[model samples]
Target: MNRLGVQLGSLPWLVLVTGLCITGLWSHQQRSYRQLEHERVERDLAGAISQALTSRLQSTIGVLDAVVGLFDASSAVTRAEFHEFYMALNRRGDTLKGIQGIGYAAVVPNNNVEAFQQQVRASGQPDFTVKPAGTRALTTAILFLQPNDWRNQRALGFDMYSEITRRDAMQLAASTGEPTLSGPVRLLQENSIRPQVGALIYQAIYGQPDRAFNSGQDRRNRLRGWAYSPLRMDDLINGALATINNPALIGTSVLVYDSDRTKPNNLLFDNLNLAGSNKLTHPTWLDVTIANRTWVIGIQLDHRSLNPQGWSNALLLQALLGASLSVLASVITRQLISNHQAVRLALSKEQEVSKERALAGTVFDSSPLAIVVTDPNGVIVQVNQAFCQLTGYSELEAQGNKTNLLRSGRHDSNFYEQMWAAILNKGYWTGEIWNRHRNGQIIRHELSITAVLDPQKNVSNFVGLLRDVSERYAQQEQMRFLATHDQLTGLANRTLLIEELTRSLALARRQRHGVGLLFLDLNNFKPVNDRYGHSTGDALLTAVGQRLLSSVRESDTLCRQGGDEFVLLVPDAPELKQLVAMAHKLVQLLEQPFNELANGAGSIQVSASIGVARWPDHAHDADSLIEAADTAMYQAKHQGGDAIATASSNATL
Candidate 1:
């Protein structure tokens, strides 16, 4: 074989080509990592801005809680009393930082509007009336506003219940008995020349504020009024960014849109217009829910936010790294023998890894057992072909769905909790579970679940292997049936007969009730089997079993105790007369001709000789009971058959 060092060192074109390929690969990897880092930075920036907004809204809402508590402390809050409380709350630093003002609106009914207006006028203000002067069934007028400056004074006595946006928030607050946020609206404090968009959070105050009402209807019925705080969007957004987690969002434009992010009319705030950005900003949006109102907060970050050293430095570094790698490869090519061996070894290892990966994929797809892979959260991420066949869901349908899609409703939540507990604790759980098929059939599965862990020993994914055990389970059930029943006649065999008799005897003894046993043997049956073959004889026994079954009560146990011999057990029997009556009924039933089984065999005839015995009278235990009944059967056989005889048959029935 020729050495690659002898071949490549003699060729300069080969050296240059190798260097170019190496540089291209290095550049591609650097670019890929750069893109990944950019996406990570975008997510981090979005999260930081969302946190700042939420922190400010939550902090401001807390101030309204103190105001609502004032009503809980006093059944009636006078205007002077509300003023004093607001002053005291404001002294607690930064409590009212972003809030425009704190106010209370009184819920007034139309019938009592005059009385409410007179009461408010008498309290302090003489010129108080519900405005803008339209007759409505209910009106919520701004009654008590704190820091009653010229801006807030315009809202006093204004009926907030008349406006659609404010009324929606007030109604929601009253019904839920919780804080509800309103959509964007022009505040009465702003003028048309430079109006600012504003929103409010309303907390409902019910009649008995401490009591937990049953439903929304109950809350609405007991509603007293609402304590609210209004906010100007520009001041609130900027103040939030300044106070909470500063420097992380510095030089970033914060814009908020109401309900929808795409509509320009819904834009609540744009700090870029205030700060004058020279270039268009790209925004990363996060939907923030404030007391049920949705606000889409978008933070537009500069290119420097994506990478710490900036994109220009990142591209320069990529060029530097690629050039360095190419130069080093050229130097190493001079010692071509060692480098060639190393490259060949790396190629061999990579080929082996690729083959292993392909083999694993083939095994997973070809296995008859259904396989599914899920994330740690139990959401299915991958499913093999067998899984689709079993579940009736395609690969596209199964992906992104939770594992509970195939839940049969047979197992409760506790069953799954224990299954997952075992898997997490011991790394695997194997058991039989019931799952529903796509055709709405319940299928039994022999399920084995394994928790796949990463190098750090944290659970990364869950692998589930399901083997359909439906056919195996059905065969098992058939075997179980054969264990306790006579196959020819479908009657209880000796095993089941003994079990039922033992249980019945124990129950009868406890209740002081009588237990009856009737041992019956077919008479004159040997000639028919000899003449018509065993098939006909077996058919006749089945017919006899059906007749005996019809004559017995539901609580009675009838057993075919091998060949022409049968036993009937009756618990809670009243007396010996009942046993004698039942025996007479069976004797007459078997006496009827089996004309249906004639088959030109000249008609078969049969009769039954029954022997009756009662527990606690003839014998106390099961074995002795059977013996006593057997002896009575011999007596009936000797007495020419076709007659009912008992241990006490000497007496008249």
Candidate 2:
């Protein structure tokens, strides 16, 4: 009786052991399967994001290229040209914000003698009533045919001989003879009311016979006026943002900065912060440099917002299948208990564990998330294929090496110290990191590191998971650019200018230094717009923006304060004379005739006014400084458009 009882106990014990083994194998298999599914999903998500961003960038580049081509073809720079160019752009009208305006600057005959002779011989008077080339309305200014009246339009006849800013831009263009994009600048004419102007500039090539001049001393080949176009905040930039495909998936923000003082705080564009679930939020930003402008584009998405229901359903279905399979196997084992039970059960559990491990390994290796395991010393013990792909290294090359092999050199030792400290304290750390690939290319990565503890609660190993974030960085850069830069001329927009001005004010107050502000209004830009159209106006604006950028010191700020007005912020000026000199230089540059085509025909002309104000001496704060400059600018305009006026003497506070 005792032996029979002992035998029963042993049988039950054996059965219990076999069940435990089978259950362990089943759990391992399920975990492996789930991990594989997660990895595949992550890879698909990463690929989708990359494709979306690439498409957006490519589209933007294409549009810019088309705009440049249009600027090169015409000299008239009119509305008709703008319409034609817009049609050529091929972007849907609802999608486009309209081709604004174009203009250019060039050298023309300055001889009053020749002008009078031509006027006497010609029909009554060459019609100087400038009208928008294609449209009857939107007239802005008139031109006089009389020789004396032509004085304002003279290129060489005037004393703009010493203007520095204009001369510099022209010189730069003449020397390089290549199309150059200028930093953001405010339009001079729009100084009175509007607070910003953005323009795009193109250098004119003038060797054509139609642009030939009679005087050997004529410097016609010198810097020609720029082909320019202006951009409005709600129009070009905002419109572009609204068109972003899957805006829910890709949250974007832009920041534009101007290295100037007079007009400092310019916020170009920002479309960040959206509400949604399942979105991957990308807080990382990247810098994109174009010409002299630097823009930051930031992107974010909520991972939870992206089809969470689908993932949940998949998980539920997987669990249900796993449970059903486990139950069926358990029942089968019980039924076959008497026939080869020991061998079948043992093999089944072992096979299941092996299959689970294989599945898990395969999933991990093919995952988009880079996975790496290291011993306590930080020497890599194992790396997945994704890790190899991210670092541009092969599995064989990465194993047994240190994680530092992929260091990009962008971060200092202190950075690593902080990272390690966080991981040690919290057991895990998550952040963005800069790393290098095998090809020496710097790459951004979203990284999570965990400290694996042993039975004694001592750190035994480290595991790191990384996802390449280069695309997200690029998107962030694009956002920053849209926010602070003028889309038209690529100058610092009003928002950026204000920020610079505020900073300049703080610096000036601390150093007790003087800052100067110059307000500019194009003397006859309106006539150019009316006669030639927006296309010509745009070309002119682009050229003007370039000229403004060239005229200032590297320390100064040039901004588009809207319409035909522009502002210059000169920090740490020694005296008012320096300010006057800059103002005069700007005036002189504008005095040069803008050579442009009319209805695809040969060249036409334009000019501008300048106003100067000094900080503390003229007024206080950004607003007052701007006001003083505006008052002086109008005074200069009243005295005759092609001149400069100082705020201290011209306006009463």
Candidate 3:
């Protein structure tokens, strides 16, 4: 009964539960490993596909770079010269796999369009004209597209800049002098029967090839044409994947979208028709940014390896093995517990008697009262936990010492003599006494002593109990302080102000001197509080109170009259002139920015409108003096604040 005797009866329950937990944990770890391995595969396969697609698209930009270079080195490139250069580069065609073809467009000014057409016709294409072009401000005419295929011939003479998508890309290329990609578009060469989403990469070729262009504006000023390659999105993604040597993607389907969102219109390529399929599990998504365009690539790995059914038989076997172990463990534990039952019952009865004695000893040591027991001659014998705490002495330190070891020296010999006299005469003593703690602090205690007597009525030992009362006395003082002061500012409140004023006035009347009162109202304080929350406002008010304290005499009483208003009572003033000068000084100090609140509150600037009044000069008593000063403070506020207004005529200082 002392400690439930370890409840050896739960041996069976403990073993059974532990075995089951081990079984469940083992199964969980296996599944988690399988899941994690599958996710790793998905991530790697998807990442590789995305990287290959991005690399392939980036590779196609090199063809456009080659066209830009040809124009850069030449004074002029005729249609035949451009065709010859492009043919030499495209002979192998492996690097430019996804590009339909590369071409150059000529920039034609609207004012000189007719002249440009005539010049182009004169150069060999006598029938060439800018197609669908009429009074365009400017045009990039596709003058030469090769390998001169039927699709290439159809686009020649078309104004590429007339289209918004192409114009935006060409404009970007011209201004930035970088290869740029167009957003999703349909190429002009695409047939109606098999139209596909398309994009274009463009590189600007400036007319003043030998002239170095320093800025975008300068580049635009000398812009000649563009070297561009049109793209078929489906072919582009396929070409990118074909370049990847990673064999992990053998059973995977790669789908590429124009951007990150997976929508029908944005879908560029779906290799295995996986876009509309729901059977794919754990699809991995990747984003590839290529030439200022973003494409989202999704890869789905074969889920056959992830089929949990493949391991169902293994898990079933594990469950049966766990059940067998649990049954064997329970059977063995039951026999062991039964064998120990008789021996444990005997030990429990023997433990009960020893525990009772220990319990009694524990209660004595743990008592809240500082208890001490000593022989009739007063040699120390024992002390409790409370005694150690109250006097800062451990039981080991106090056991062999006399009771006088605690005497604080605050009481004279007569105090101890009286305490002993009462104890010996009446066999008891009770009184408040002072003792010195081990740490050299004086502690007050309410002490009581009684003599324990034998059958013959002779004293055998004395028992003393004491309770520490120092905290109770200190708390009384704290309560008094709280009642008379503002807790936040630690300044005297209105109650203390009245008391101090009454006493100061009586002295002033006998001494024939004046007392000054300044009532201050912080200008627009509500707005400040509203602007920066109450906590900051409270901090500002406390700072103001301390600032006023720093500039005042120690005898002066400063009080927070409530809100942002405060009152300072100067007991003995030199004159009305000095008092007003003090008021102005306070105003100046307050107007300076508060550095304490600068970290979060910014530069906080506060000003005070102070109303100054004097004893017998403004009014007779404390309340009347405060009222007169408050009225003058309002007058100061009306005069735009940050100034002093006194009750004395005009009241300006």
Candidate 4:
């Protein structure tokens, strides 16, 4: 009986020992699986965040590229033309803060400064002012040449070039032939409002005829002028923070810096700088370069602020699962425990594998943004449903094809080469691109592409994400029309006309060619408006705009400078005779009777006094060219309405 009792006791003890050993093995395996799962999650999270950041950067680059392309291609960019662009910027301002002003620079002749200054002063502001380059100077002024209520006449003569900092920045931009970012410098224009650095991105122009250089001179040899846009650092930091996916994790600290040493010591941007905080072992920094401007985006997430509940819940679940397994092991003897344990082990391993596969599948299938996978030669390999929706194409149709199936033909082979070069060197490329939809309509999309490298370090696949920007483009175009064009006549407004003239003048100087500027004032426009009411006057103006559009060559520009004043720019004219003949023909066209009217009052006859100025002959630069033609127009008007006058006889209006 004693031997039997001992045998029963040993059986339970032996079962307990076997149960504990099984539990230990299961726990060890579970831990290993969990660790692997955690690593995988971390990697996915990193990749997602990186992709988001890349998309944001690409969108910003696209906007900048559009602006640059417009500046490079168009003869003149008016406030109206920029209206759509400005609105687009404003709409996306949350994504890109800090952008302040966009402007162009034209060489003004030293000789014409006085006349220009007088005109500006007459218009209620100083004509010009100079600031010494590289100094800390803060002063703001406004000038105007036309009567407009919203005009900032105070900024007219403010010598921005005199400021040492602005000068240094401009010089740097000219030297680099690339957009250069300056350290935070105080903006005199916004001084009383808030301390802001003027981030200036400038493009150089050469051979302005208004300067000492003649048409034969190489303007490109010397920097003639520059176009610049200012960015505020504080605003940029705020914008970046707004774009962060996990805003809650952003905490209260952020810092932005320019990594370039040649630039100043100003922080690129700063929100709540926690430079001395103990929670931060090292600053988390992200380097972004767009349009040749480099910025170091830094973020600091406070450890204490992170929610501990997530980790706690995960631990609790782990413990519960372990306990459940142990209980099951204890209930079974060695035979049952071994069998059950084998089943449980297999199930756990299967679950872990399944979870990994699900994670990868979720990443591939559930992303909100469109993703396209292409093989090394730019042939499409696979595309997610998001891509299908974006491109209006099915998976089967896109697969096994070159990306050119969606090419809008808006960009040339050179453009593609440049894109490839960037990607090859940096492993990533981003920009705004126009691609054709399956239905053959052009679609503008902001795109981000990343090169996936194989173990051999060669690019094996490329993943691209695209966001449709057609609406944004439309909005921008609308804004531009509103700002630079006359609503009544649909012709170039004074601002736009002047910009065009200046651009043409520069071109004339470059080509050693002549340009004609014609200033025309309707002879009996006031009488007609007074007699026919304002509505009729508007109709007449619209008719006049149409006539002018139809009468001129494609290279010519016609504009209304308010009231009955009109200016025309004819480029590459050989002599003043051609301009005079065109002006005479225009006058005759206007003098002819018009039958279309709301009143239906038979017909109306109109005539105009015309003034002509020739580039390199009557005037040298934009201001002088306009002034001379304007003066001549007055002379023509003084000589009884229907006539023409040259700048040789400077008659004031």
Q: Determine which window of 10 residues in candidate 2 has minimal summed lDDT.
A: 142-151
**What does candidate 3's lDDT look like per residue over 1-653, in tens digits?**
52543666777778988988888788777767766766677677777777776676667788778788888889688988986686466434255545667888888855477888899999999878888868878866888887664346668888888998788888888888888888778887665544678888888888767778788778877888888888887656655665566645555667777764546877777767777668654577888777777778777765544532224435555665676567557655665666677775565555555654665576567666889989898878999988888888898999988888998999999998998899989999998888999999998899999999999999999999998878656755564586678766999977688788888899999999998999898986666665775566778899999999999999899998666889999999668778899999999999988887875647788888998999889889876777788778878888886878988863555
Candidate 3 runs further than 4 Å off: 1-19, 260-263, 274-282, 307-653
lDDT of 1 at 295: 87
TM-score of each: 0.47, 0.51, 0.45, 0.49
- The candidate maximizing TM-score is 2
Rank candidates by lDDT, best first: 1, 3, 4, 2
Work out how many backbone clashes candidate 1 has. 0
Each model's C-alpha lDDT? 0.78, 0.58, 0.78, 0.63
RMSD to the hidden true structure, all candidates: 33.6, 19.1, 30.0, 17.9
Worst ten-residue run, lDDT, model 4? 143-152
Of 2 and 3, the candidate ahead on lDDT is: 3
Question: TM-score for model 1?
Answer: 0.47
Instruction: Give per-residue CA lDDT, model 1, range 1-653, as digits (tens).
Output: 36865676655446656777877776667667766665566667677767777888887678878888889888899999998787566544346655668999988854477888999999998888888886787877899887765457668898888889999998888877678889888887665444688888899887887788888778777777899988888767755655445344545666788898667778898866632345544556788888878888776565654542234554665565556545544544544434568885676566556755875786688777899999999999999999999888899999999999899999999999999999999999999999998789999999999999999999999999998878767855664566678767999976677788789889988889988989898987766766776567778889999989998999999998666888998977769987898888888889999888888647788998888999978988876777677667767877776877887653323
Badly placed stretches (over 4 Å) of model 1 are: 1-11, 192-194, 211-215, 244-248, 273-282, 304-313, 324-653
Backbone clashes under 3 angstroms, per model: 0, 123, 0, 28
Give lDDT tens digits, candidate 4, residues 78-191.
Answer: 544555555445433233333444445444444354454565455433335532222233222222111211112223355556556766666666666555555456654343
